[model samples]
Target chain A: MTVTDNPRSYHYSDNFLDFTDEPARSRITKFEPGNAAREQTILRKLGINGWGRWQYFRTCFSDQWGESKQRPLSPRSQDRFFEALEKLRIPKDSKASVFLTDEGNLELVWLDDADEQVQIEFGPKDFEVYIEGSGIDDQYSYDRLDEIIDRFFAG
Target chain B: MSVSGTEDIARAICSDKWDAETGILSASLFKGAETSVSRLSITPLEDTWTVFRKNVEKPPERLLDRIGIINVQSLMDIGSNFEANPTRLSVEPDPLDGYPSHAIIPQKISRGLANKILKSLDIREEVK
Candidate 1:
């Protein structure tokens, strides 16, 4: 049967009954690492040595340990990230690469971080942030910086 | 294929149509509604096929734009969006792969400079 026909049955059949009613936004806000060691293992598994592309080598440079992109990690951004790290539930294992977006200066891509597969896109330079994935695609423009940080990052 | 064989496949894609219920882009290779053995395929795995497939989808007239509806377009778009603009990636193989070394080119590498980098890395551009 089509998914819309009987979502309950479909969920039971696909074993997606585990899917939570809690929103992807809640998942991002409530995320917290089990421990530092657990997060380190994930970085190691995902290969921590990402480098810049040969063609666009300069702008997309990365240290791979944590930083990704030519620009050094912003002190404010890093501090915010550390604060988020206390709450964000990083996935156990996945192909997701947490990197910085280059659209308008380096932005945080807390991309695909949770079990719900939520991807958040944020930019301080251009004053824009958005959250997407798990079938959700919404935007938070330059005006909503404080709201985004308080809702999604601040615990 | 010969001139006529190529023409037959094009006709099938238009008249006979495609079987895109599956993600694959397959059009009958022969003229008639003959056996399904004769078919041409386009998959997203091959890097260059997209350039041609994209060309096919450019004509905005078709009511049923097979290429547009198929999920492969999104796959290619997302992949291109990500890989075409990546923060970091390295081709240097690990120690197990004989300690492959990569050169750090200058800030702005010329066409010739890029060629030299590839040559130094022993990576010949695939002769298409």
Candidate 2:
């Protein structure tokens, strides 16, 4: 079912709550040697490294680690991972915000403000959702995200 | 010059053979002649030559006119069709695939610059 259709089935767990409360700090702690070592091992297994760190972390945390009920994880633990990411103190000029929906979708909101706002949604189920506030094309939305981030960070 | 010679001069200026006295010809003449040219020649006519020079000169005005003439209903149709049948434009691999890069920001220095701007404008508080 869609996110809106079955919201109750996706109740927020303690892990999700804890991570969301202080995402930046929580993500940093999770990325450390001890807690996310399994995540690192999984990243290695997936042949991901460097810039792929966070993405790989998300994938592993979702598909493998989250799904393994026998372990100390659930099938939607990536929601917690993303919640943690949202709290992280990115550069103030960094207009990117990550959010985890009840339905386990990870949303990346960028270029959000009065003039224009763009949202890129992805999840373990390959759900891709994009919304643009200014009625611009999705390509424009994607390009705007790239432009804002590039212009800000590239300085 | 004869009317045909004047027309030929118009065609030459239109074909960009000789620069016109006013730098470009009138829009009415340009548009009418432009439609008569062969389809294969249209690309060079449109790109290399200033076929839409007048339109380009006042792009904002032209854009506003386009919006006005097309109306919101047609625009909605176009947008819906585009959303339903999006085209794949490129297939290039990402350049910073292996680096510890932020996809949104270009590099650390740009990030710093953005931070400075944000701090100056007090936008950092909103983000925090």
Candidate 3:
């Protein structure tokens, strides 16, 4: 079954169920390392599809490493990116990759079969988006999580 | 041989700069400061792929396993705003010991231009 047809069943086949009704915005206000509740809240929302990318984010954060300088991943940017991922689940068939930028921000890139691409660099106060496909190649700046979902993620 | 726009340049790609499953390279491989021009090190192929791959090394933790190849003309021909706009970016030799083919792109690279550049690359893995 397609993801939209039976999301719960599809998620269950992967043995990952996101059990939360809380808004992603509320949980991303801050990132506390030892805060289990906060971590679970976001992790569960990721389900199976995003678990690996989330792990990479955690790895980059803890690594505190780069070639030129000690450019560790930004905690606030990580929180914002986590919030974005919570809202926009990567489809099982599609691929999404995360990267640590030189400016200490997190970039999430999503690509699908139709050649649709959405790339967002999560910053402390805002995020930048690049959407390309079907003759549309444009960039936009957004601050709210819901608007990003509604504008880009919504079908 | 000297570096030229007609020749291709190669750069070491760490594990983080590319995705094995998707076979897609991250534009983060080209990110730099937003203000002043920053230097990105690359090696001109100069008809010696084996030697270039052997000499460009990285730490064990950051394995130099993948090499991304793109023509220098591609960077010089980077498009902007979905159009062909003139860019001020430039590339030149900045050789160091044991790396005579070393070159550098001395400019502030935007994510858009980086994306375009990576899209034009031929990435090979297990270089070393």
Candidate 4:
């Protein structure tokens, strides 16, 4: 096995579940890096700030489940997620929103004008990023938080 | 999870079956390609029930009880076919919500659709 930092060395995901029971083609593009500032500017125009409101949680969790299950995100992981975004440096500009997992992990989803979606869920140990498009879905994992972020920017 | 809720949710998310050892409900939501699917899982805490979401896609699953809470230490061993994207939610014990937290993310549904689902699932308000 080869060990390297380059994405070219990394393998494309082989684990895909086609509940449709048919072949699916992935929809992802690797291109020249774009400016992060532009993506940030477009994000501002879109008006998304990772949903900092507690009311937002109240609305999403709704009182329906009604249990102590809903605890606030810890500053440690929460800050890590915020820090992870800066590391994401996704050159691709798209509509993005952030949400929390039940375990207080952070999730950020971005959509381009083409309607493709990229979802990232920050875990305590590592982070996962999945890109969705046309006929295919792909997933990638990294031991370090920034590792996945770099893949987001590169591919 | 009655004794171990870890495997319960894991199996439910992948296989849609209940595991007696783990105290998790069947709350898995898949949309678009596998990359875009959201997850919703539930576990009974000592006093309350915990629900986990990856991307908020659809209505909640039928709630059920499992054996017990699994050891968090052995969670990595549970093994999953898909990668855990940091952009979505993960289940855990906490007081604050994740980025957007439950009922958010994996947002392909229209606001009208989201509201409709919320209205349908809202236990606080009786659906007419």
Candidate 5:
């Protein structure tokens, strides 16, 4: 098959979810890159697990997501972020703030029981974890993502 | 104008930087990796970032626009933890392109400290 015809090149499946059934768009209007269908597709590709934060995450892919023309989210980083999310057991009740670094990587943050922020920045190959006001700072390959998640959420 | 630790500073945030789910700003907004000067841009509330802009029908709307207000003292408190070379962190005026209100936290901050500063943000409101 031609390089462009490769199925792996496509980011997301065409049919994932019916975002039309959800409530009308919220107040955020500055970052719309395309029509409603396109927006829904972007959200679906991001997966439905943490749907609440997906809307915010989807905008990171836009060219205008930053003020000074930050690089658009790279495909490598996108693949890494989506793959990593599948292994994380983010607390159902806890909210996590999402961000795209200057290097076009993904960074997820949430407050721990002590109200200190915990950051997980995912690069193309490896990810780094940093716990605020603590000494827990280190990097791990994608293979160890599951192990890290389990340790952090172990109850 | 000299920046003071007591004054409140406003940093313009793009829509993506403000998480609607958590109703807070992201730590990534404070990263200096892209900045060649090793400083993150901020402006005092008294002057605001818009002061640099010239005539426009709707000034704020044309901007990539949300403001996160954080106290300079709060920034200094967090910066103290990430002291580099034993030099204390402080905000200093760095006017650029006629933006006299422009100022910066003159330090290379870590993501952990950036997150701490993110939590210290006193206000996250849409600019009118």
Candidate 6:
């Protein structure tokens, strides 16, 4: 129940999800404070402003769910966020595209220069690694579909 | 019908240079669309505060309704924690109950990747 002021604090919440099923390795690089500043700067550079456009919302998790965290933007926010993101710099020859799943979760796909795929889920309250190396986890993927519309409206 | 227009308006607002006049324009445009416009403006703090209060009073009710559930849960959890260890609690009841309950740790995009992306965006000049 500690409230953190830094946007990077959200990164820990990202790690919490990344490590939810399997504990994240200590070596799994943690984002430095400066990186968060960079992200804020990037957001600023991309001109993300005001509510419902690349905005962050509070999310409450039941005790059964471990640590609670705020969710990223809703589908609309996701759309606007990524649209702004499209204006951002990504790796060379890598393509980035975001999709809102039928269930309302956001799937961000980053294709490496070699065309390898990395997929991540951006849900109402957390972000999780959904797939890597071209495999899908349908169970975890659709488990929270009903909540998508809810999060979209909430954002 | 107005949804797409609103979306366009949002895009315009996002991409616009953040100046006092643009802020005023944003406030007016957003207000016309029935969205909260106070935050979109760069007016004097007092004027902005007044607008913010009025603007948010009846927010996108649909949006507020959804966020309200999350807020309620957070408040209840905070209340429970206080009951369990009131001595450890320091802050007063949150005025904005919707505030996130946990700390956020920032994550950095890989430097190599950031450089690549920056180059691709053609805004490397802005990336000092």
Q: Among these predicted structures, which one has the highest DockQ?
A: 5
User: Model 1: runs farther than 4 Å from truth?
Assistant: A1-76, A103-117, A125-134, A141-155, B1-128
**Number of clashing residue pairs, candidate 6:** 11
Share of true Cα-Cα contacts across chains kept by each model: 0.00, 0.00, 0.18, 0.00, 0.33, 0.00
Give interface RMSD, every candidate, in order: 20.2, 27.0, 4.0, 15.0, 6.4, 15.7
- Expressed as tens digits, the lDDT of each residue in A1-155 for candidate 1 is 68688756533455333445543212122233432553454344333421111112122232221101223223334334333333444443433333332221222233244533333433332233333333333445545555655775454
TM-score for each candidate, following the candidate numbering: 0.26, 0.21, 0.68, 0.35, 0.62, 0.21
Worst 10 residues of 3 chain A by lDDT: A21-30
- What overall lDDT goes with each candidate model? 0.28, 0.27, 0.58, 0.34, 0.56, 0.28
Ranking by lDDT: 3, 5, 4, 6, 1, 2
lDDT of 3 by residue, A17-58 (tens): 344423232323244554465456445653343455455655
Clashing pairs in 2: A24-A87, A24-A88, A66-A74, A153-B110, A153-B111, A154-B110, A155-B110
Model 6 chain B lowest lDDT segment of ten: B61-70
Residues B1-128, candidate 2: write the lDDT tens digits: 11111111101112111112212111111111111111112223223123323322221211111100111222223323444442211111112322111011111211112112222221000111
Expressed as tens digits, the lDDT of each residue in B1-70 for candidate 3 is 3346676677667555665656556677875532111122343333344544344322234345466777
Best by lDDT: 3
**C-alpha RMSD in Å of predicted model 1 compared with the true structure:** 23.1
Q: Model 6 over residues A1-155: C-alpha lDDT tens digits?
A: 45665534444554354543321222232343443553564344433332222222212110111012222224333433333333434454454443323223444445545555444445444444422343432222334444532332122
lDDT of 4 at A48: 46
Using Cα atoms, each model's DockQ against the true complex is 0.01, 0.01, 0.15, 0.04, 0.25, 0.02
Model 5 has how many clashing residue pairs? Answer: 0
**Which candidate do you rate higher for lDDT, 4 or 5?**
5
The residue-by-residue lDDT of candidate 1 on B77-128, one tens digit each, is: 3323442232121111111122111111112222122212222221111234
lDDT of 6 by residue, B13-91 (tens): 1111112211211111111111211111223333333333332322222111001011222222333443323221112
Model 4, B10-127: lDDT tens per residue?
2112112122222111111222112121122332232122333322222243232221222322322322212332122223322235422122122232212221222222121112
- The predicted structure with the larger TM-score, 1 or 4, is 4
